[model samples]
Target chain A: MHKIALIFGHNDYTFEIEKNIKSHYKKIYIFNLDGQSVSKDSNGYEIEAFDLSEDWDELRDSVNIDECEAFCILEDMSKNIFLTLSLRETFKNLKIVALSQDKESTDKLILAGASKILPTTQTTANIIVEMLKKPMITEVLHNILYEKSNVKIAQIIVKNAQYFDGLFASDINWSKDYNITLLSVIDENGDTEFIYSAKAKHQQIKNGYQFVVVGFERDIIEFEKLIGGADE
Target chain B: MLKSLLLDAAYKINTSKNYTKTKHFFYNLLENSNYKYKKVFDFFMIALIFSSVFILIREVKSHVNDELLFYNNYVVSVIFLIEYLLRFWISGSITEVIIKQSEHDVMFGAEFNLSLALRDIFYQKIRYIISVKAIIDLLAILPFFHELRLLRLFILFRVFKLFRYAKSIQVFTSVVAAKKFEFLTLFIFASIVVFVSSVLIYVMEANNPASPINTLFEAVYWSVVTISTVGYGDITPITEAGRVVAIFVIIAGIAVFSFTTSLIVTAFTEKLDEIKDTKLIDDIAKKREFYLICGYENISKEVAKKLVQNSEVIILEEDEQKAIQAKKDGFFALHYDPGSIESYRKLRINIETQVKAILCLSHSDVENVYTALTVRSFNKDVFILSILKAKANRNKLLFAGVNELLYEKELVGMIAKEFVGKPVAFEAIHALRSNYNGIDMQEIIINERIIESFKAVADLECHKHRIILLGIYKKNKRNFYFNPTYDTSLEVGDYLLLIGNMQFIKEFTDNLHKGK
Candidate 1:
């Protein structure tokens, strides 16, 4: 179970973010930006209020970032950058999903200690690419990602795994071995392609939405289990 | 299991490893599509239908060996028969075999059935004329069946069948037939002019030899050409009386021409211009206010409208060229591919952050999901109403942080039940649709005493103004539930979504505001 911190700007969006996160991570702390017209009544969700202008120490002490698996700032890059820097100083291994307002903010967000800086522009572009390629498959994708009934979109960026490369999708059998399903790929170019390679017994580095996937919440635990077994 | 079996069967019929080969086979055998060679074939058929009949007639009269023409006639007849059979086969008319299909088709069936019948009771019907023409054509080729000489003579009415090849001629004929009584009244008035002109021209041109107008027919011909402005100068009266007649005729010609043209043009141009300008775009900003451009790809038009309920939209379009056209169509347009977060920024999407959410409709699963993903990445808190195009993409977008998901197809289907049949629903909704082009159809609930009395939601929205109530989609979900009465009382925020013409919709809104 990843301990994640989600900081959002709007009520509805915050509510949705929480709902999305609840499926993937058992523990999540959501913080909403102050002074927006959104409220509990207007927005369909309860937003955990937080001031963006708060001192770094105050924010850290308030949110407790030291123990989190990931810190996601679903807001403008400048604010996200501040949060990333604040969180990085306390927890160096913490993965950050820092939302970038524009492409210009990406490099700075990374420099500010974000492990993952998802620029809004790139996400939207990759979305379009995915839609154009497999036009109607997004419905199935949404069913898994948004609904808490069974699945979640989790990412384990291929790194330091010699055995991970050159394996077909079917052969991966992540569901059987690790209780996860590979939904799509997000390539290095910010392009997204759906992973429908049922015959694919091998996998390669294909950057796109095709690499992103729906998997059981326990898949990450399964991954950690394998890691523990390897260590022993 | 049944669904899978059907899908497998459909897949076997349609899909192929080599698409080109499959396409060719289907194109030649099933489709019989004349797409690539349309222009060439259309002209060829036009020439063949008329020229062949002409040749057959002339050749048989000259006694220049009849079998070829007869054989050609039968071959063309067989082709028509085959074509008609294919049309009937594909139309699946058996499935559509209700008692009252097209009267025209039924009439045609009656004529054919009657002509072939031994008693020939079809000859008693008014449509029997068509049967007679077909009979004549059959007779024209009867040399193969050892029929006598009366078979080859084609009547003037038989030429009408060739009019099917002429669209303009068919329109002319139909119009002429419809205005038969009016034409008769016009004929009486025209004849009076003809008679007066004849008498006057006779008195004046009696002294002139070059333009001798001694007869009524010559005078009538001149009168018609001058009045109609055809003015083919084959025959005319040259005397002073003729000049007087010509002036009256020429003026009449211009008047008649203008009258006919005005009537037709005025009747059709209003709807035609509206259709021409009607186009689909994702976004358009009105009055510098941000708006959501909704598409089924990921959004519903209704929800899109709801998302931006009292806000203006700088309608962002997926294509810049489409945006330009939308601009020309009187929309405040912004060009940005909603799927591309970069396009949003590059197109100054954030520059006008005053925009309401770009409600990616959930019904358009792919587009809605993509738009949501991209949009959340940009402004995590922006309200995005997504319409799930299908049930599958719903959860994914919900996870992606879509504010709302409204299914348009399901909505339209649900509303269709309110109508007895498709025709009634279409006619009622057409006004609503027309208002959306450059104009909008928005219905609001008014509690002020200025407007007329209202008990039910429909009364407040549709009863007095008679704007077509598309539905009663409440804003209570977005706001507080002010009007909780399931029976009637519309509270402040509850909206009455009605569709009406632009003028009426505007007037209706203004009245609601004024408390009228």
Candidate 2:
């Protein structure tokens, strides 16, 4: 589980963000300026809380440095920088993930030693807009990727594949030879379709067949050499 | 005559494409330029793509039904046979296509000397990415022995297919790609969940009465269903003690889902409002000895892309982020943002000549605008481009005598619309009206050394290749214009801010510099 420190601008940002990221992380500490946003999670791991920005010297006196982990600056830019910078000076190993209102804020946050500058809201809408674009492709690709798989979805183009060109699936000894399973092909005209039969074994595949495959990394690399073509 | 010839060439490149040309060429060759043959070819290719999909669906069914497997194999094989025959019938030369990719005589170095015509056939140098997808297309058809083992497995690929069909999925995928480092950890976490849960369930319930949970497969199934909160209950444990352990498993399930969601959220949030996939060139006008500054970040990249491309951009950014972005794009940039008076003095402006523009592209537009104002007080002739973040502060920038002001949010939106548009526009624009996490602008340079000449620019065949010239800023002349015509001469020094078809970006770049 990823360790995340949730810093709030007030209480709301901390509360909402912690609720969202709570499920994904192993441990999350939600802290507002008031130092009391700790809520019971549905799971057993109770989110810890703290707020040093409110009473710097005193709060700094109370919190234990050794117990803390990476931080997520969910609050507004200023307090996010102040608390995060203070936190950084001591717990240098703590990953600082801060949110920025815009580019200027992103710069300030970076100088203050925040590891990543979150663009805050523009990307969210872009994602929505991106979704509205060619939704079918998105749907198909997501289903393919999100599924449980020890294997990665990859493609290999048949460049100058001499041995496998005319050979069909039944004909080419992939299991014995390449150790990569040939899955599909995309033609020169940008048409992608499934490989049908052993017949493809005898007749050579036309130019531009990008083979979809699943296999060990070593064989995939070898197949990529044959199909993905020269990077040039 | 030369001008007219150039114009004619431009027209030819713009009006036709290889796809269209090939279609026409085939029709003419068959001596059936009339309507009949055209329809036939279209239907044939369409059938191939569509039928493959059908075959895949049928094979999915065959996986569960043993008797149906025979028919699936037969039907699939027949389709492959027909596809092969049709390709041979259509293509003029089959051997040339396959053999042309990997034939290498021999290369002594790491870079394979695959360019020579007489290279060996076994290693036909694969030049196109389409070929990899071709193999995938083929694999999608050939019925594997998978269904005989597990039916739930088919849902896996079908889901991927759904995402593949949507535009949002493309954006989602890009956001994921941008944060691949972060996502990899999540993936590893997911893998551990599946692996550890399986072991845990097996160890905990091996002798239990409720669910034997003997096989690793059942453990995997139970884990997935439980984590997803589906709780199919087909393989539930009957033992009371096992129930206690199951609660912990369910909790793990919730954590996994929550974790995965945040990963997507983080990636999307970072990518929002970003003005990505465009190159900036100085605006075209009479040269006033402008200095081109090529680098940008929040201040550097944002402002450089916002200003006119035709001007001499003496890009200054000490940050490696900005410097690297500039170098990868082939635009000239100095490594420094002249924000401070000391930095300005350090520029060592010949003062007498050669420098007539000062663009303070730093993170804060306020700082940049002020820097411009500061620079102008000393050298009034220098045109300054400032990067200011707030729209409310436009007057302040103008008061600074900045020739132009680039608002990161606004510029990101405009650049985004130009590069990857239709579904997604300027992230800045989207964010103001929509629920965007943030907006940013990025660069997509037409790589150096792809085509021998600027012929690719004139050819207009790039769109097919999925690279678009959103705006062309002629570096030599210091002129930039939006959506340049097909004939726009693309010199080595020129930078094109383009929105590449994100999916094909890798393919396009792979073809840029011959691999070595």
Candidate 3:
């Protein structure tokens, strides 16, 4: 039930981050540096207008800066770095999370005394949002994230399997017969390739090859019994 | 002859079996006929209606021949009357099916009351006479009753009956029907504007010496003409009050006209989009052979370019701009999500039907797998060629039922590997892959008909066809013979890999089929 403070620049990424992590905190405060009005109740969070160019006395006096968790997500790198420096100077015990627009900004934010730095160059939130849009991906992610799933991703090595050698990747119906997803394979040369991929499609399954599979723990054990393990 | 024909018709109607057959025939003709029969009937009806209209138009002229007009009208009216009678006769009662039962059946025995049956027939006949189509048919024949001058106007309703026959008119009417409320609003607004303007003009110009609008009717006409921006100079308002009113009317006219026009345009464009979507789906379903290319990227574009020469290519691209560009490049492109099963359903993909092969060329391996899985679920036999970007998702895709897998990294690696040791070989491979304007390689399947006319590789007359016999793929043996000997006997199920000019290769393949 800790209070959190979000410092924003004029961009959608700040709003997105606020939306994603809003449920974890008890009281959330969003400060728009450009003096632009941010909707309070729309995102189920409290919003305030503040200018980064001003002194920190007013901000520190307005909010309980000593106990609050701060996040600097300004669109401008310099502005974000300055805000982090100002926040770090005012509240020595405050945990400051700053967003870096690039590699240089990442180094600068670290030097500016941010407790943690999140690099926005790769934009992981966009990837997550996009992945969540697909129903299958959402189910897989939901199982991995929220549910205590029995499914385990395991890499099994093939040994003394006469029926499987020289068989094409497409020839096997792993899901239908064995209830397992054959993810990829590692060859005798220790080079891993996707079985259905062009690189591994022509590669014959030798005795020392390993297959990375995803399935229930019981199914993997059963599959291991059918195709002899790499230890044997 | 006439008396004998009448007696034969009466005797046929009295016979139950013949009556049943006649009823069935008329029912088919009127309601549930086949495509050709329905088309013939519609055309005949449309032609009759138009000819009646033409006769009506001709009757308006002063120098028309009265005798010929009367004869034509009489003949057309009799044909219409006969059609109406047939339609009415076939409009049997609900109990007609029960009445058709054999007399041996106790429910409809020989002792069944004939008076009840007669009453049902009379009731059905009365219902038919009151029906819309029957009334139209009656009106069509009404012009023949020239004794009643008032009934002559009913013939004009035949033109409106044409609305039922034409599909475009039906669509138009439905669109109007859907937007009737909006149209009513506009009509009310326009009526108020016209009324107020007429009243204002009458007040302003009634006593003015220079005003030409004298009567209330003239004022109303002048107001309408001026507001519609079709002002006739004969009825100009010279007074200052009249000029101001004219200005306001003109501005209101422009606003209302543009508003109504935009409303209609919006409705029309929406209808057009609906029609285009339906037509595109219909076209895809009707095509006997076509390739469904998922993802309109660079690789798929190249694949489409190669296939477009000898086949139809339907592209489903998620990117709207790319799909539009693909369409501009002369490919049938649909801006739809490839991973969605709904889009595949819209394309009507079926086994051994419209689609020959599906190329899943999306950059994302997961997306390709999903598309392949959806398509394979619907059609098990269709050739699903997917490109694998990530090596990790390969087996999952294969398990998902992709038929052919093209490894992107492996292809690039192979080419790079060959570049060091065999530069000349690499160049030849590159040339073939590029598929430059002049020389092209095509794979032609040898069917039963082609095998009958086939001889040795030398007797194919490749030189005459401006083609070089590259190799032959033996189907049964599953082996490729590169540059076979002249005496190699051609067999059925052999794939002829020939390299030649694009035009000649097409001609040679076409001739090979024709020679069968």
Structural similarity to truth (TM-score) of each candidate: 0.41, 0.27, 0.46
Compute the interface RMSD for candidate 3: 19.9
- Kindly list the per-residue Cα lDDT of model 3 for residues B1-516, writing each as its tens digit: 643453344445656686677678777676642324766887898988887788778777655577756655687778777877777766774344224422324464455444554566677688888977677777767778774667778888778778657767767776776788988998888788889988998899999877887888988898788767777777888899988988888898897788878888878887897768767876776677887888876567666776776778889989999999999988999999988888876656554777777888787888899888887776788878787777778899899898767654333322222322233323333343244434455677778888778777766776556455545767677565644666789888787866556777889988888883
CA deviation > 4 Å runs, candidate 1 = A1-6, A20-232, B1-48, B56-63, B68-158, B165-192, B206-211, B232-234, B257-516
Q: DockQ of each model against the real complex? A: 0.01, 0.01, 0.01
Model 2 Cα shift for residue A204 (angstroms): 92
* Clash count per candidate: 68, 151, 2
Tell me how large the interface RMSD of candidate 1 is.
Answer: 22.1
Please write out the lDDT profile of model 3 over residues A1-232, one tens digit for every residue: 3455444553455555554455545556777776766576465655667776667787677777665777777867898899989878777888777777556888999998998666543222222222222223323322322223555545567875585767865356555467665645667876655444466658777777777665677887999887776221
Pitting candidate 2 against candidate 3, the one with the higher lDDT is 3
lDDT of 1: 0.48
lDDT of 2 by residue, A1-232 (tens): 2333434343333444444445455455445454444465443334445565444444356554344344444445666677768767766765565666566777877888876555643433233223233222222222223223333345555666565545554345343356544434445654433333223333456556556554555666777776555221
Residue-pair clashes, model 2:
151
Tens-digit lDDT string for candidate 2 (B382-406): 6565555567788988888877655
What is the lDDT for A70 in model 3?
74
Task: Please report the TM-score between candidate 3 and the true structure.
Answer: 0.46
Instruction: Report the Cα RMSD per candidate.
Output: 24.5, 34.9, 18.6
The worst-scoring run of ten residues by lDDT in candidate 1 chain B lies at B416-425
